[model samples]
Target: MKIAESHPRRRVAVLSTVIAAIMLYLFIQDVFGAVKKQEETEIITERSAWLADWRWEAGTNDLEVVAGGLTSLQVFAAYFDESDSLLLTDKFREAMPRIKQLAEQNELNDLYLTVVNDIKYPNDTDSQKNTSLVTRLVADWESRSRHIDEIIAALETFGFTGAELDYEKIAEEDWPKFAQFIHELDYRLQKKGKSLRVVLEPRAPIERIKLPKGPAYVMMAYNLYGGHSGPGPKADAAFIRKHATRMKKVPGNSYIALSSGGFDWHSGTGKAVGITEKQASELATRSESTPERDKASGSLHFEYNDSDNVKHTVWYADGTTLSQWIDAAKAKGIQNIAIWRLDELGSESLEQLRIQPGYKIE
Candidate 1:
């Protein structure tokens, strides 16, 4: 009877061991499967960046580099004529075919015609960010309607997907009318099955003012340092975070626009000129001075002298800097990024733009 009992105990022990092993295998599989699913979700949420502002002055070389990589592109095409009607530049006319071809190749559904508040003179020089024009257009009902009609006609003529209002330097008094104009324009565009995007300056009183719903709003996060200011990075982590927090007040889908270049500030003169990532990098290489990254801004700055022995202080963003800026914005829970004017961007910066988001540039 004792031997029989011992055999039964042995059988029970073996069965218990087999069940535990099976349970362990299932637990491991469940954890790994969940991790895999989470990774896939992250990939889907973290998408590519939206690019814009292919200026005629900048040419189409940068566009050629980006090509199908862009989900949508804003061509800096439309400006105000002498009559305040839409004036398409000659360069715009010449580049439309290439632009359309690129759109076709990329199958882009969001090709926007960026119309700035710039008045182009007969001689082709533009008076940029004219506040008077914003007041005049929005304050007068007829002018605003006519302008919208012209924009619609232009969009239809050029096969553009939508219209982007890059109007800047709006006065505080003009905010109400501007918001009304946006609402009316949005209505018309929706009725016609078109889209609209509005660009807001960093100085715009987002919290104090009321903005219309529907159209996407892009906040200009650069220019923390520019021609208007002394030598500094175009933006820092704190600056981006502050703007991202403020952008929450904006309605609908909002994007934070990041600039890819820096400015060259000449000392004593207090004048600065815009320089692209490639230009800045080449300038540093030529000067034989390595650029030092600012920890707060993740931007590179270096000083060099010209043939005239004039001291020049340069601050700019490269690939790694852009990545850091993107990370800062991401930390604030803002994902949509729009690059300001992709012109002569460095190869490294271009690579950073092309890669999937959430990955750091090392």
Candidate 2:
């Protein structure tokens, strides 16, 4: 009887030992898994901290991802009708919710409403059509003042934090009127606790257009090459440096707008078409071409043959090129960097900016 009882007790002890071993294994696995997850979280936090010193501005358009992971966003062109009244398109209204969502996710300050007078949409139509209308509007002080008042009312109604005046193609003669209009609008917007931003051409007569205090002036430093122009770097390093120097002379806050997209120029007709980075890469791959970077311009270019057997040359900026531009801008004392359209930025391009040294995302 004693031998049989001892055997049963020994079997119970073996079973208890197996259970303890399994429990220990699970505990170790859980601890390692948690450590790995924490490391990943830390890496993500560090990545997001990049670009903290500079303001990143993107324009909102048909692309859903335009505002993704950006610091600030501007709604594409709320146009002005022939009556000098502000027109908010249905498309812009529809895009606001998504833009706001992205802003919240990225911890952005506020969404900016861009005001323009360009008539055509879906494509950047010629501003020539609206030039006459703008001239008429600015010529009449009373009419312009009333129009500005209406714009202020619309801003309050739409819940926009600020407004970006993107009125393009003004005749050089109308520079003073345009400047006065901005001054008045800036004054009124400030009273309501709002801000104003002006988008000026790289060659814009900065001396002529005097902005009111507290308004940011964004220099359009892109379009050095595009669909309309011959295939070349969108903006060369030398050109950017020259304009950056001019931007420094401006009195208040200023920003440099850079191009991150490329244009596919048809070798036959010289007709260039806008293409995203992904599209450009896919085309290059299909044509068995490798993109080459121009060290002098800091741009990437490639030649590809299409289904029609037509040879085309593509010129655009990528992550590496943009990184070089940012370095140059920082060295030149540029405080803010704005990409023309955010949707053009690829994952790789964004990653390049993330790993750049000496910047933090706040």
Candidate 3:
């Protein structure tokens, strides 16, 4: 209270203490910001690794199949969701041999159930129309609500390991029914010494969709047709990683960025369909009306070259974009990569897919 005759040095010391405190606060804030940025986007997540074994899409080796083959993911989609009658009765008798052979392949890990949403819906039965390959399910929900059982029986019968629900083009109205199907199916699979592992391949928000409590959810915002809409894989990986880290749980075994690289032209309009000029031109002139998305002209022929050349082609198709994909994946700590529809791919195109980082051909 003596108006404390403070020395100038003492005043300077007090000011220095305040300044240090401010610097420390600023340093903490900067650190928090950097961590937030890294966790918020796929660019900083973690890249893929060799720690886990790989999976590859299989069953058929057409162009679609081939393009999907480059990654470790196996068997594009199991082509399930056929007629409810056929699914229930095992009407795919003729296909048993192939399925059996596929099952026998030791490298096999997962089988995708492509039309997941269509597995429990109704469709027109007009023979005149050959548009939808999807024969939406119309079987007993109680008996067939267990779609997992439907698939597990086959997977178990064939000795396969995994199944994917590739419900790509589902309408919002169908989500409830789809959710019910998953719940019931997973319950059934768990009973028969078979536990169900689901990949929530929904195109909508994970919140909007109902999923089994334990199924692995592959969080994605995809436009099956609109390839490069959002920041794409870059942003997607980050978004998914953030939730995964915060939730302290990882859905979907690996972080996969969906992509296709077979035909650069859509059959109808301007879409990429992994085709060559010849195939596109043929469909264009055919009395067999062409679908309008897009088409490729002067496409390279997929004749057999060595695995080296095929590998080169597989690695380069969408060269620029894939670079972004791989880079994003590495950033997101994503280890497993699954491509859809490997069976639709062509041979040479498939041969080019890289099973590993370097050369991989037997």
Indicate which candidate wins on TM-score.
1
Each prediction's number of clashing residue pairs: 0, 3, 48
Model 1 clash pairs? none
Q: TM-score ranking from best to worst?
A: 1, 2, 3
lDDT of 1 by residue, 282-325 (tens): 88975656889999999999999887888999999988888899
User: lDDT per residue, candidate 3, 94-119, as tens digits?
Assistant: 44455435434533334333223333
Between prediction 1 and prediction 2, which has the larger TM-score? Answer: 1
Q: What's model 3's lDDT at 193? A: 46
- TM-score of predicted model 1? 0.84
Mind giving the per-residue lDDT tens digits that candidate 2 earns over 331-361? 5767477666555467667665334223343
| Residue range with the least summed lDDT across 10 consecutive positions in model 1 | 43-52
**Model 2 residue 256 distance off true place after TM-score fit, in angstroms:** 0.3
Each model's lDDT: 0.82, 0.69, 0.39
Residue 151 accuracy (lDDT) in model 3: 74
